[model samples]
Target: MELDFSNIKVVGFDADDTLWVNETYFREAEEKFAALLENYETKNKVDQELFKMEMNNLELYGYGIKGFMLSMIESAMELSNNNVPPETITEILNLGKEMITRPVELLQGVEEVLQKLARKYRLIVLTKGDLLDQERKLERSGLTRYFHHVEVLSDKKEENYKNLLDHLEIKTNEFLMIGNSLKSDVLPIMNIGAKAVHVPFHTTWAHEHIAPEEHDNSHLTLNTLSEILKYLE
Candidate 1:
């Protein structure tokens, strides 16, 4: 079914993977982490356990590199039966630091899409992660000038989006969200009477994956951020 965006006045963009590179770094870090613990567990097992650890600690730690770092440390301890070297723990800390300090790499056509859309729509960023990390990326992105507001959310659940839209006085009908994660960005926004566009990135975290049957084909899914121009611009 073809959906209408004619009434959409506010365009929300997801920061990680949508506008800039993110998941790829996490993948790379996971590889390094697996290698660090290869002696204690297979890479596959290490990856699985780490994801479980992150989920277990999500409520306590929230979402961010810090939480991921702690999860890695804990996973390493469990996988190694608490025999993992202290140096391995230090390496995990360094991995998180490296991710935080890495320069933001904007995805293809991000700036052009933002610039064009900003002219006619209220463009804002609605992303969930470490607040400071997101802010740092936005500042380094050099695209901050195009956005009217920047929000770093704790999570992207339906209520979170609803609350933010209400707080910003943006009517649900007038809001449109674009992002990489179908679970976080597309489904929840669509559920809350808002429009959503899925612009998939090359890599997705395991936690963000959803079964194909879970989504209906009502919303738009673009191959790249620039393709959105045909609909909105």
Candidate 2:
């Protein structure tokens, strides 16, 4: 379907995968975590239980690596019947810290795309995460200069976008969102009468997956991150 973008004054980009490497690290950490707990449970079971732990803790912790580490620890203790070795817990903590300090690596063409769009429209980083961690990634990314506004939302739901549009004083039709997750990025923005583009990252957190029937026909998916330029330019 051909969608119009003539009135999109504010273009919102999801930071983690859309602009830089993120979920991939989480996946890596998860693999290491499962290996750490391999003695207590099968790797497959460890993976499954850890996901459940993370989902159950979402309300308490929101999104980001620290919460994930804590969940891993909790899962570890439970799997080992509270006999998990102390060194194992220490390893998990180190993993989380290493992730927090890892250098920000932007996706290919991120800078070029942001630079191109910023010249024509107001650009913003509208991502979900722990505020401090997200801000640190942005600071390291060096793409902060491209965005006119930056918002770190607790969650990307329909209401959140509605409130964001109100706070930015932007009409729904005048805003566009681009990100990697259909659940958190595309659908919510679409529900609010805004435009969005789906840019798939190689690895996706299972929670972000959604039924195809729930997606809006108006939303677009680009084959690659830089394809948005073809539509907007």
Candidate 3:
């Protein structure tokens, strides 16, 4: 079946893994975090516990390094039976601080794709995370010039997309979303009758993983962001 983007007048992009190196940092942080707790638990156990903590705390902390930092600290205390040293907590905080300050490394062909798409479509950034962090990353990415509007959502649920579209005065039929996470970016957009293109990042956070049954065939998936030009441009 052929999908059409001829009606798409607005294109939304996800910030993290779609446009730059994000999950890679979180992965690296997890490794470092696991290593820090190796004395009390195995690396694998530490990894599992940290992910559980993040999920449990998702509602309270939302997302981003600050929340992740808290999860790591709490996980360390639980995994170590509250016997974890103060220095270990400091190190965990440092890990997140390091991530927050790390330079934004744009994915391959991100700029090229955005540049080309911006000319024909009203480009916007629709990423969800800590507001300040996402804004900082966008500033650091230097790709903000290409987007007409930028929105940092708390989550990428269907309602979030619908409300944002309405606020922007963009019709559902005229909106297209491009992102790496099928769970966050593709599923919701498609559910709302908008088009979506999936460009998978090499590393995806576990939370972003969706069940096979939840997968919709209506959206397009590209191996690389650059390939989108073949269809959109």
For every model shown, the clashing-pair count is 0, 0, 0
TM-scores, all candidates, are 0.97, 0.98, 0.98
Model 3: how far residue 6 lies from native, Å = 0.6
lDDT of 2: 0.91
Q: Which ranges of candidate 2 are over 4 A from the true structure? A: none
lDDT scores in order:
0.94, 0.91, 0.93
- lDDT (tens digit, per residue) of candidate 1 on 61-149: 99889899999999999999999999999999999999999999999899999989999999999999989888999999999999999
Ranking by lDDT: 1, 3, 2
Candidate 3 local lDDT, 1-233, one digit each (tens): 36888998999999999999999999999999999999999999999999999999999999898999999999999999999999999999999999999999999999999888888999999999999999999999999899999999999999999999999999999999999999999999999999899999989999999988988577788899999888888
Which stretches of model 1 miss by more than 4 angstroms? Answer: none
Count residue pairs with overlapping backbones in model 1.
0
lDDT at residue 142 of model 2 (Cα atoms): 96
lDDT tens digits, residues 51-151, model 2? 99999999999999889989999999999999998999999999999999999999999999998999999998899989999999999999989998999
Distance from true location, Cα of 31 in model 1, Å? 0.6
C-alpha RMSD values across all candidates: 1.0, 0.9, 0.9
Which is superior by lDDT, 1 or 2? 1
